[model samples]
Target chain A: MSFKVSEDVAVCGGRLLKLSHFSQVIGTIMNVNVYLPKQYYSQTDNKVIPAVYYLSGLTCSPQNASEKAFWPFQADKYGFAVVFPDTSPRGGDVPGDPEGSWDFGVGAGFYVNATQKPYDKHYQMYDYIHKELPTSLDEYFSNGSRLDFVDNVAITGHSMGGFGALAGFLKNYDANRYKSCSAFAPIVNPIKVPWGRKAFGGYLGADEEAWKGYDPSELVKKVSNRGNDRILIHQGTKDPFLESNLKPELLLEASKGTSWEGKIDLKLVDGFDHSYYFVSSFVPEHAAFHAKNLGLI
Target chain B: MSFKVSEDVAVCGGRLLKLSHFSQVIGTIMNVNVYLPKQYYSQTDNKVIPAVYYLSGLTCSPQNASEKAFWPFQADKYGFAVVFPDTSPRGGDVPGDPEGSWDFGVGAGFYVNATQKPYDKHYQMYDYIHKELPTSLDEYFSNGSRLDFVDNVAITGHSMGGFGALAGFLKNYDANRYKSCSAFAPIVNPIKVPWGRKAFGGYLGADEEAWKGYDPSELVKKVSNRGNDRILIHQGTKDPFLESNLKPELLLEASKGTSWEGKIDLKLVDGFDHSYYFVSSFVPEHAAFHAKNLGLI
Candidate 1:
């Protein structure tokens, strides 16, 4: 859990650290981006700050969401922490392809715990993100740095990341696992989509029953707690994939008739599409949402 | 001019155009980033909009000012145009740099009319940005697009680009040239600095008097326009180049002892450094400055 790429981002010399951590479940080292806020050093009484994990969509590495989205500004302002992990495991030791397209292989990690032979060895993104990443971040970044008033944990992501964030939050649901779970252009119900079919089948074998465990729709149906206090989703009306991969409607369906106290706010912003331009447009809102829920701002 | 980079940037479409012109003096082809208000297409034009051109420091193209600092969101609210031009001409068979360091070569096209050999042929950034870019934009972007509200214009830049913005406004001194001028960590008093010495010596030759024409301090000293304009500068106490390259004191000195008509607002943002992070922290303020001048919220 040593830092590799460190850049001086803000005053008080707050540093953004990118580290390579060996995920025990996946058996591969994953690169993660961490924004150590301005108060990290000043209040070094070992207080833990609230953290929001941002998962990237397809064809994106940890760098895409960090550099392109300008996440540090929001992270710095709200005085919370943000963690960016690579979308998927690479190298053929993991399953090579689910139909081998740009949308699936290499870049698309789908945030699932793989069950198939080749993939099961390395494609444990669910555990790597939900469990391993938290453990690593706790030991490495918070060392000697007070993070108090920052522990309103939240999970948020974009597109595939949105799905991943949902899974990460639901499966790890504790009394205070995540205060909020929000997504930008999230593919809410991945179990019924083409992307989900290929990725789930290739990584999790031919079992649709197992897929339900990772599916947001199924998770809400089976689990009653849903410790994430709220879920906010922003969907673009003009998103070409809105009707297909990013079916926000199914999540709406899943939430119905459940005693779960979590609220899902689905906002369809006009003229927005599935691009970084759209993500960046609403990124401030998303950051503020988590910040408010986390009690940072 | 067609839009190349227009998606939803903070509720508006940010447009960038590749402009080509038969400039009698400078290069024939250049690119500029244009941010149009969301209402530009939707609103019926009953009024005009004000715009500001931001110049970047050394070793950057027009895209640097746009990408490094998320200017489109700001431009959207300002309801004005933000044109960022390439610092200098390239791909023309001009003198190649013998030195490889970026400070002297292609990227560092100091916004000055070069008199030195090799550079003299095409190093006409001053004219390109000032005359050519404006002329082309006025012809193509302002008139052809729904940007009729571009009646007011302001200029702002960072580091060397800041010097260029001030020098351009003061040298031209148009009540119409720009309604305001501002900067973040600008290299003020370029004629009296080491960086200015090398760049001016190389481009404008060793004649200090000739170099003075390109210096903002000298230009501000001669300001005759006595009403309704002000200059704003935000300097960082921790900027590494504060002592040598950026002399905000020189600008203050030149503006002293005269009504000068134009006000100077020099601010020292505490603990900020000379990075995109620093600029980004206050980018909204600069954009709003132009917006208020543009008569839009």
Candidate 2:
């Protein structure tokens, strides 16, 4: 579980460490970027920095959010580290969409453990991201206990990765895996969307029942949110895929009459599109939300 | 003199207007991005917002700085609009480097008005940027005098664009064209550097004397700085082009015994490279400097 430091860049008041490590779950080399905020390097304070994992949208490597999400400044402001993991396994022999489409394969891992052929080999991202990657990072950075990866963490993402954050948070809701959760233009109901249907049909096969295990809308009905715990979400009104692929209202509708009712903060911001421009504008608010939940405030 | 709005993107309490217009000086269509800060749209405030022009480095369209510089937040904070102009005239029959190099052609206009063959047809960036572009923008947005693109403005850039900012600011020092001037790892002595020599030779021809007209190092000796004016600069020690092409020390040496002596704030930051990562890291400091000079503090 040793990680190779490919590049350590100084950004804002901290360092963004580009790391690559071998994941036994996926049997491949995965890349991830972690931002160690200014507080982590403070010589006077021996505080353990909590991490906020940020998952990127489709067609994004760890670099997209690291470069444009404007997270480093917020992380420094809130005294928390940020972890940016790749969307999917890349490089040789890793199969992509059979038709050469960009929406699937390669950059579209969908963050699910594949149960189908060809993809089942390396598309074990559900395990790689949630189960193995965090533990591995916790073990690697255990030198001085200056950074915490396992406990006292928050999760957030954009678009496809946003859906992944919601599903993952809901699946591990009872265990309280994440202290806070938020999404930017996320596909809340994956089973009902075209992008989600295609990714799920390919990775989880024809069994729609199996797809429910990873769908946020379905999981919202089964999972109960602890009292006073709220999930914050921001959706752009001008997003092209709002009606067709990202029906965020479905998640709220599914939570009605359940223990999670009225706990989802769905903010429909006007005039914003589904670009990093939209993701970054709302990042400051999300950072503050996560910071408060993580007890940094 | 008319600019067509291509995309109006909502970001950080304002809008990023992607505009294209025909340039009478360059004899071609050009692209520029302008961010109108939140104060511009405020109903209660009638303040005429000042503009800060951010010239981009080599191989960059106006989009590079608009997307990555993290300037919107700072602009909103200081109530200043940001103007991002293209490096050169692009598309159509406009010529690039004869050898197809990225550093000289297309994106590398060096912000000069070419006096040589072929390039003279379209490489009129000096006139376009420092003169025509600003006047045209001022005219285009003169509805209620909400934004002051001219008269009250500052200038700053990175790498080749950094050189452009310094040269432009110095050449027009007597007129006080730009109220404040700053740069991020700019080529200070273009006549003495490889990138500068190649660009000057291609644009201005064999007469080395003509190059001095656009060289900041030479201009610093000729131009007298106003009593209280100072130029801010931040250079990364780890920039790959620091030694070979970006000799920032040359400008300091040239300023010795001149009116500009001890007025150029040259900050050498350690461990930063020549990417947007480096540029964005120091943007807040530069923003504050320009904000103070522009009287927005």
Candidate 3:
């Protein structure tokens, strides 16, 4: 339940704490990087700093987004801590893609709880990311009562992690798990997309009904909007995976006539691609969106 | 004299143009990345955008700083373009380190023209970076006269590139090549350090006099300061190579009684390492310094 600090780096006006801890849910050590804004260190008025969780895409560790996403600056500006979690569990005994492909094994857990064969033992990333990770972080950093990891928090991600954010947010919509949600070039209709179909088939088995539970397109139709809550999303027009693996329009189409209609603000940015260059470019806007939703404004 | 565009990426209200060109000075193809800020595109006011050449550290290419330095946002903020130059000439028939080390060859050009045998063929980085590259860029982009790659420019770098910026700026001090200069964890006294001695000896062939021509510590005493001009620098206290390789204080010590005394602003930032994390953290400050010097602020 306790995290071991591997490196505490000074970035921006705060510290980026690279932490590793044994996960009871995933049955493996999970790595997460947390950036505590300067407000956390010098809070004479004892203000409770909120947190924003940023999930990464395939073939990325906690280090990629921590280094290139340019979140530390915005984190400092909004007085919020940023959490960056690993894409999947790694190391010994972890079963990788059977075909030895990058999209299926090792780096690509797709943030799903596997119900299939060999994967069932360790690939419980859905539970790990949404449930245990947050609880553990809340317990670890809430000692001083200066950091709020659970209550006053927002969520955002890129690519595959975008789908994870949409799915996770909708699944826990009734409970209000995340105050706000946003994604950069996210895989929205995972059930319809090739990447999501493969991941869902492998992790949740061929049961399409089980896949529906994690599909954002389906979730938008099922989950009722509480108030005037909106989900911000930015998709690149030049993204290569647009038509094939990430059909974001399916979510908008599915949300038609549902409570989420017109509530999913999808902005297609011109000339942007599916890279950290794209993610970091619009991070300022997303940070501002999350900041307002988290009441930091 | 012309550059080939490989990847033109849209990032942070601008485009990052990944370019490769045949260098007349180095006798090989050199890769570079240039970022044109938003002002270049929507220029109804006809502003002449200045350029800032950022040299990378050892074991780095133009891509390292282009991807992680977080310069595009600042460039967009100040309406100045950024040019990221490769550390060394690479590829087909280009010889690397004899010892197969990262610090001596390939990515570690040290930004000096080599007078030695094998290295002399393609290691003319000093002339390439400070001379031919700028002249070629000016010719290529000055068709509209909206981009000032030559007349109004600044230079800044990290580690080895930091040393390069200082050496290049001082050697061309009388010529007034760069309007402003700054560095992040630079190798100021390279002639005295192990990395410097190895690079200088290998490239300049053991001639201490030839090495002094590219040493900032030596050039600081030789080059008279023009007016109240200053060089901004940020060195992380926790940088691993501070003591043995990057002794920044030596430059200040060398400038003690010279015309450049107190003109070198070396800031010692606490708890920061020698990673892009540290560079990106201080880039805004360096950008502002260069902006003021380039008359962008």
The candidate with the higher TM-score, 1 or 3, is 3
Q: Write the per-residue lDDT of candidate 2 for residues A42-154, one digit (tens) a residue.
A: 89878779999898999999999898889999999999999999999999889999989978999999999999999999999999888898999999999876899989999
lDDT of 3 by residue, B1-297 (tens): 999999999999999999999999998899999999999998484889999999999999899999999999999999999999999999988889999999988999999989898999999999999999999999988777688888899999999999999999999989999999999999998889999999999999977988888899999989999889999999999999999899888999999999999999999999999999999999999999999999987
Q: Which regions of candidate 2 are displaced past 4 Å? A: none
- For each candidate, report what fraction of the true interface contacts it reproduces: 0.20, 0.80, 0.89
Between prediction 2 and prediction 3, the one with superior DockQ is: 3
DockQ score of each predicted structure, in the order shown: 0.28, 0.86, 0.93
lDDT of 1 by residue, B66-94 (tens): 66677767766656767777666666675
For DockQ, the strongest prediction is 3
Model 1, backbone clash pairs (residues 3+ apart or across chains), number:
13
Worst 10 residues of 1 chain B by lDDT: B1-10
- Which residue pairs in model 2 clash with each other? none
Q: Candidate 3 - CAPRI tier?
A: high
Global CA lDDT of candidate 3, please?
0.93
TM-score of chain A of each: 0.89, 0.99, 0.99
lDDT of each: 0.73, 0.93, 0.93
Clashing pairs in 3: A97-A105
